[model samples]
Target: MLKKDSLLKGTIILAAAALVVRFLGLFQRIPLDYMLGSIGQAAFNSANTIYLLLLTIATGGIPLSISKMISTRYALGRPDEAKRIYQAALMFGAVTGLLLATAMFVLAPVYERLSRVPDSAVSLQAIAPALLLFPIIAMMRGYFQGRQIMAAGGISQIMEQILRLIGGIGLAFIVLGLGWGDKYGAAAVAFGSVLGSIGAFSVMMWFARKLKKQDRDEESAIATDKAAKPSSKLPFRTIYREIFRTSIAAVVTAMTVQFVYFFDQSFFMRLTSVFYNHDTAIKVLAEYTNRAMGIAGIPPILAIALGASIIPVISSAYALKNMEEVQRQSSLVMRIVFFTGVPVALLLTVASYSVTGLLFKSPSGYDTVALLTAGAIFQITMMISNSILYGLNKPKQPMYHTFIGLGLKVVCSLALAPFLGVYGLIIGSSICFIVITLLNVRTINKEINLNILGNKWFAYLAAIAVPALAGWGTEYLVLNLTDAWANKVSYFIAAAVTSVIVGGLYLIMLAALRVITPEDVRSFPGPLRKVLTLVLKPFYKRAA
Candidate 1:
């Protein structure tokens, strides 16, 4: 039902929105880290991790399921069936979200006790209601995505992040000023999540209503006289059955990353408590997971944005049995993943201390941050590959791989964290992601000749190394030259200069190495591609 140009345009809109949301998320965490301190942050992280896990279970798979099912039916010219499926998904989301929210509220205290974070139940309870609302928002977004109209979903996401930023930061200040304890302050911050969800749900509902009106207007314009046949509408029970069947695999595959984090939340403190006091362990984790990895999480958003756009695009392509288009999209997606992911990961590694200090006001845990940043290369790969598998209708493959990866994460975390502390956790995560990425890539290769990690891979490696090495040299020189100028402000300035130098050089390297071709730039959003065209004209000429 979606034209090619519209699909590409929608993907670009969503990807751009995703980038903005990631930036807003980073801004939100800055104030949160400053206000909550280590122990308070540890408590918030504990509750938030559980909240994320439950949220994933309640809302994650259903959207993908809705998108896939609706895309398929719509491609077959079955608008009535697609609409019926949307209705079923909405009802399902409402019931499921309510049950999950109630369950989360009831179990909040138990989770706090298990994690040994004091007063975390307050935050957990505060975030529960959002679970009931997010499912509805996700379902509506899925409907729009199924229609390949991604701007609605994109704008709704931006609205959520903007509101959450304002509400969380403001509430944190108010709570602290009012002499509330850190727990209540954390809870107030958690309440911002609820507020943000409400905003998102409202925006999505508006879009859904507009879409409905458009559909009705179009139907009226056509002026069909025949009464709609009952047979045209799918049976509700049958739709539900199919949805559940697809949703099982989708839920498991989608929850892979969240489940890894959930495992850490469940066991990290207990394991660290073995080596140190409970409070001390939580403090250390606050630095490692909460702060360091928090910044490290940004690069993967590029992959996540691409993956979200890829699922429906690839699904529709595969649905039509258009192998050529499928292959073309798959190749483009993988190239973008590697070309962007590698340099960003390496840049973070090279400037970990500077960036971490600038962002979190502390230069500690650079090694942990570097290791995690390195691991994100594989994380990005795994994310995009899994989406490709899901798009190709092989969702169970990713589910099985996720199980293997989860098992590895638990085993490695328990085995390593006891001895090496936070570093152990970092190592375990890296190994888990690497193994998962390999497995997913292997399966994808068998399905289609992706030619991934061949030929141009060495060029990708060179492109990553040159700028990263130069950036590191520049930072070392600057730091050594200005040894007396060592403060957060200084680090911030150094980071800004180094980022511009590193980023500019990396782009040049990509141009020189032909890792980013003119054809590739053409695939980008119109404005971005045009800017790149002007900047890289010589490189295009050289490649030609």
Candidate 2:
């Protein structure tokens, strides 16, 4: 029903690139955390998250909608239509990006007050320029994806993240060396986003040139038929209408992950003000944003990659009305995300103390880190399922579900933050994701009679429970055993050792439980499959 190995290969490429960027972010935080301290890191995160929320709003829906629409057209043998759609998307992206960038720059002070993080307004203003370029880059990436081309996008992502990291680190060092306070240092780091966007734009423009050449070649080949048809006269207004129809729902669905964080960013301080003093509220929100949000955010990168990759594939299938194929891909992706996401989340939660200690000089946010990381499982599932819903052409389901879940999140956080502090916000987020994930899966099942977990729900719970208990035990033992501790080098050894032992044990249990069976392993792309086979050899063998 589907092309050979496209989904596997595309997902693996995107996943690998996303993995590098995500982990690089952790390593990037090390020096930054030292330079900024918790308060400064808070400033960094406050500006970063505010910038990201607007970035999502500007680029999120357009790119995804392009991918979906273009893929649907191509599946119907309308390559000319697909090309026209991309052109329209490009113009739209440029205009939208300029507007959003201007809005961000003009409203930086408003965001600073809302987030209640001191020294954030300058950083927010500094990061706005990045918004001007990235929307175009994102749309181009989506076009490549619509064409089922993955390399250009993946390479450009690496380029963007690498330059961003280098620029941020370099600028922050210069600011701090000049004896500027954290205020300017944070702004300097935030300005690096503009540098990163330029790098990404360069890579994307190069790819765009090649893509245009290919498009011309395609046009010449099809000039006698498709391109000459009356259908090719489709108007610009129709393009805008179609894009907006999908994009409005798409934007809300895309915000599912960040919407909760935006709530915390905007209201956490204001809500908890009566219960805690200004300094105390700021400290708690800082830890919540910097440490908790940082560690918790890692594993979901894979899900996001897989989710995005699924769009074109799912759109093609949905275009054909092949619900069975949609069902197959949906079930496979859900299991893959959960099976992969659970262990990593549990490890981070169990090892949050060591991880935070390694990254931060004075680690005081381990509890928040643990809470957030523990929630990543649900976060990962919710994301993949959201993608699945989008593929089903039920784009509005995730949008509505996100708002409903946010309502609950807002209520739970407000009602409890007074009593429980940061944990209240985190617990509220966890509940939100869990509810949304379940709702999404239920909707998918209703639409396609999807298979979710089947008889393996307990198997999954055991897979989660066993590794968590063991990893927690191992962490406690190591922390208690190591008195020569708290230094970065010492924490590094503890983290490395714990990761190896826990990771090995977790894989063994997964194999023994048959969480990933031989049939499932075969669906993986060749390189990943080979590596996984070798890793799982002692516990489970692969078919030759």
lDDT of each model, Cα atoms only? 0.80, 0.80
Per-residue CA lDDT of model 2 for 268-381, tens digit only, reads: 777788788988887777778766777887888878778868876887898998888888888777767766777788888888888888877656888889888988888898
Best by TM-score: 1
Could you tell me which 10 consecutive residues in candidate 2 have the lowest summed lDDT? Answer: 1-10
Give the per-residue lDDT digits (tens) of candidate 1, residues 1-544: 3222376677778888889988887777777777887767776777777877877887777776788788889899788899899988889889888998999899999988887777878888988898898888888888887887788888899999888889877988899999987888888877888889989988888877777888888778885645654436678899989878878887887787778777776777777766767767767777765766577778898897789778888889989989888888888788777766777887888888888777875777677788888888888888899999988989889889888988898899999888887777778877888887888889887867785445777887787888888888887776666667757767776777778878888888888887777778898656657878898897668767
Cand. 2 Cα-lDDT: 0.80
Q: What count of clashes does model 1 give?
A: 0
Backbone clashes under 3 angstroms, per model: 0, 0
